[model samples]
Target chain A: DVKVTQSSRYLVKRTGEKVFLECVQDMDHENMFWYRQDPGLGLRLIYFSYDVKMKEKGDIPEGYSVSREKKERFSLILESASTNQTSMYLCASRRQGPEQYFGPGTRLTVT
Target chain B: DQQVKQNSPSLSVQEGRISILNCDYTNSMFDYFLWYKKYPAEGPTFLISISSIKDKNEDGRFTVFLNKSAKHLSLHIVPSQPGDSAVYFCAANIIQTGANNLFFGTGTRLTVIP
Candidate 1:
């Protein structure tokens, strides 16, 4: 079974604060993704990394950045968090196959 | 623009009844479609999938029917149980694109009352 773990299950941050969400996968999948889910918006891709240090912007990449310095870890960074950035964050990892294993998700509340 | 759409935001059914969830896609390049189930506070989980070449796929109580001509698909859960209640999201990907990204729908929340 593949395991994807996130650094935090819930986080509360103040406005204009820097925030980081970390994800790690044990499967060594080359493909990793970050997504935010909001009511009536579904899962919108924020960023994705296909390989180490390789990143691509998804549909909604604004106000967010990603880092993939190692194979197993992927981090999502919010340079300066805002109230609008509060939402559930999900991390997923996939190999060459179509199936993507996902972490439990982190619910971030920016006050 | 949302390439995949689930117009229904929510559905309710009695326990032991059949639950049908529908999804529509506007992109012709998508060759594979998948359904994911998500619970509150948890990430979405892979539920079922179907290839464009095949019109139907079934596993246990879950069956997925695809209509290529209409660019639509449906998921049917038989004898729906309370545990099956969750948010169902339909996702699609283009195999030819070789990109691992998948287009997702807004999702429909299913509720099964015992």
Candidate 2:
């Protein structure tokens, strides 16, 4: 079985604070993704990394950045948290295919 | 401008009944489709998938039917259980520059009554 783990299951941050969400996969997948899910807006991609040090902006990448220094870990950074940034963040990984495995999401709340 | 759409926001079914979730896409370039189930506070998990070449795919009690001409697809769950209650999302595979990414629907919340 494939396991994808997220650093935090729940988090709360004040406005203008920096936040980090980490994800790690044991499958050594080549592609990793970050997405924020909202009530009426499904899972919108924030960023994705295809290889170490290589990143691409998804549909909604504003105010967010990602790091993939190693193949097994991917981190999402909120430069300065805001109320609008509060959402359910999800991380996924796949090995050069369309089938993706997801980790338990991190529910982030910004006050 | 939403490429993928799930017209129904929610559905309710009784246990031992069939539950059908529908999805539509505007992009004709999509060749692969998938269904995912998500519970509150959890990430979406892959349920089943179908390719454009095939019209139907089934796994255990879950089955997916695709209509290429209409660019639509549906997932049917037989003998629905209360544990099946969750948000179901439909996604399509889009290839961009040799990379395949999934474009997802807004999702339909399914509730099963015991």
TM-score of chain A of each: 0.99, 0.99
**DockQ, in order, for the candidates?**
0.83, 0.76
Residue B38 shift from truth in candidate 2, angstroms:
0.6
Instruction: Please report the candidate that would top DockQ against the real structure.
Output: 1
* Residue-wise C-alpha lDDT for candidate 1, range B17-58, written one tens digit per residue: 999999999998999999999999999999999999999999
lDDT by residue (A1-111, candidate 2, tens digit) is: 999999999999999999999999999899999999999899999999999999999999999999999999999999999999999999999997798899999999999
lDDT of 1 at A43: 95
Please provide TM-scores, in order, for all candidate models, with all chains considered together.
0.99, 0.98
lDDT of 1: 0.96
Q: Which stretches of candidate 2 lie over 4 Å from their true place?
A: B95-97
Least accurate stretch of 10 residues (summed lDDT) in model 2 chain A? A94-103
CAPRI class assigned to model 1? high
TM-score of 1: 0.99
